[model samples]
Target chain A: MIALDDTDRAILRELTHDAGQGAGALGRVVGLSQPATWRRIKRLTEAGVIAGKRLDLDLEALGLGVTVFLGVKLALRGRTALGDVERALAAIPEVQTVEHVLGLYDYRLRVVARDIADFERILRRRIMTLPGVGEVEANVLLSEERLGGPIG
Target chain B: MLDDIDRRILRNLQGDPDLASADLATRVGTSSAVAWRRVQRMKDAGVIRATRADINWSALGYSVEVSLRITLEKTAANAFDEVMAERARSPRCWKSRRFWAVSICV
Candidate 1:
């Protein structure tokens, strides 16, 4: 496991809240100079502690107003088959998040769409045709609140 | 409506939000002040929710990840709230230290 100091954790926390605030701003929050802050961030990124930066765009603003969660049961349960299914699912633009979860299903999918018609099209034309896919269950998500970061 | 400039700015920032305003301006063919203003406007408009750091949890010795499926009893009043409150106290959840994105289905 990679070791993280208090300063490193503080920096991560600050970045988790707002990475858009560049190195200089992040430094001010973490009590480090801009160059020192940049160095630490660079080290973290290079060491694989900080994976990547992501832009959280509003889906409704982008015309995707519906959110659906899908539980997928596979006909063939194998590593290769599952990988192929996941890759195919990921290729769909509307498929926002895919998780190979435990418990009730083999895979869980989060999909966003413009409306019911658009979601139906995706389900029929794309999702159902994927290899090894069977017994797909859909749940319309009413709301989502992100309470924690991936790093935590 | 988002014009070409707004689209360009979003695209550039989405790829590398760490870019300085001047560099972003150069990429999108806009002045530094214009780039800054557009970014700020997008943030205020809620088009850009947040830029976040992605962490590799598995590399942090958290090799095991499990998703729990909890169903509240329909008969009990405030069962959902009670169950969630109980869950909130789980040490494994590390709610104080980490974040979890919770989705509610109605």
Candidate 2:
């Protein structure tokens, strides 16, 4: 693991808040010179600490108003079954994130749709038709609070 | 309120948030000025909230990731608010979402 100093941590915090900030602006925030800050940031990037920059899109504004967390249980348990289910899930656009977990459910999925009817259509036509799919439970997301990363 | 061009710009932005205006415009088949104006308009409309560094916590020694599904009791009126407030105060709780009657923490 890479050992990060206070300045490194501070820079990380600032970057997490706004990745679009130029190296010069970021240097000003963390009390470091532009070149020094740039070097450190470069080092961190090379070490894979800062993965990449991501745009936070507003789903509601994009007409994807409904967000559902689905807990899916597979009827069959095998390596091939898992792969098949995952591959099929990747083809469906509405299935945003698929997490294979060990608990009451085999997989947890984050799904988005225009509305309830659209979600139902995806559930009926897309999700249910996947291989080894069984008992499913869904929880619709009402609101979310982004607390950000562990840089405190 | 997004048209085909706006959607194209957003799609490109999602893949590469740091893409220069001229490059983004070229990718989306639009001029640099049009691309800049659309991005500004989206920002004003809150369509594009923020561009953030996606830090790999695992590389920073945070390897284990757990998802907690919490169910609050109906014994107190302020129980949900209190729990949510407490979660908001914690730095490790990166994201917390409230569903119908369940809270998921990640």
Candidate 3:
């Protein structure tokens, strides 16, 4: 594991807001020279603390106005078929998030669309088409107090 | 450069991004300059990443966030690589963190 000092923690907090900010500015805020800050950032990335950067977007702007979770059941049990189904699900545009789940269901998904009509379209046109799915149940999310980032 | 005062600053600042530098210093039991310096140092170290922005996505008329979890048939050829690629291009997922052959959507 990569050991981080207090200074490192501070750097993480700042970068979480805007990774695009310049190194010089970051160093200026933290009392390190630009070069030193650069080195530290490099180290953090290498250590997997920084992970990766993403371009966050608004769902409404993209015409995806609804969000829901899905629990999926598969009718077929073959590993090869399972793999094919996975690929098929991934190809669908409406799928936002997908995971192998625990509990009553075998898998879950987060999906989005402009409205219920649109969602139904995706369900019929795309989701249900996956080869091995036995059943898929969807639940619209209510509220999200938090998404990601540092949640202490 | 971060001392005890710096830790105090972090605790206060992370909890409240709007806390002014003066108020932040006061909370940390340090002079404004010391607080500023320590905060600067901590920032450089990449610990405290950024000032929090309370973005109301819904206020901007964004839809609720969708969450997804998917499983692949374990025996399919190159299925992992295929799903992984879709995970990369997915426009709807706000957060997609990879796990052991499984991905978490947020």
**Top candidate by lDDT:** 2
Worst 10 contiguous positions by lDDT, candidate 3 chain A: A143-152
How many Å off is the CA of A30 in candidate 1? 3.4
lDDT of 3 by residue, A1-152 (tens): 56667777667756766665767998998889999999988887766666455433445543567786777887665553666776777778678667775566677877888897987788877877666777677776544432232221
Can you write out model 2's per-residue Cα lDDT over A1-152, one digit (the tens) per residue?
99899999999988888888889999999899999999999999999999999898889999999999998888777734677788898779998889999898889999999998998899889988776888788899999876765875
Output the worst ten-in-a-row residue range by lDDT, candidate 1 chain A: A143-152
Find the 10 residues in a row with the least total lDDT in model 3 chain B: B97-106
lDDT per residue (tens digit) for residues B6-100 in model 1: 88988897788778899999999989999999889888999999998877667667778776555567799998778667765564553321122
If the candidates were sorted by their TM-score against the true structure, best first, what order would they fall in?
2, 1, 3
- Comparing 2 with 3 on lDDT, the higher-scoring candidate is 2
Docking class of 3: incorrect
User: Candidate 3's residue-wise lDDT over B1-106, tens digit each?
Assistant: 3456655676686566556678888887778887777766766665655553332234323436544556677799989789767765654444544333321121
What lDDT tens digits, residue by residue, belong to model 2 across residues B1-106?
A: 8999999998899889988999999999989999999999999999998898988999899997888888888888998999988887878888888886332221
Q: What is the C-alpha lDDT of each candidate?
A: 0.78, 0.87, 0.64
lDDT of 1 by residue, A48-116 (tens): 877789888888886788888888877667744666788899999889789998777788988899997
Candidate 1, which CAPRI tier?
Answer: acceptable
| DockQ of model 2, rounded to 2 decimals | 0.54
Backbone clashes counted, model 2: 0
Score every model by TM-score. Answer: 0.77, 0.91, 0.54
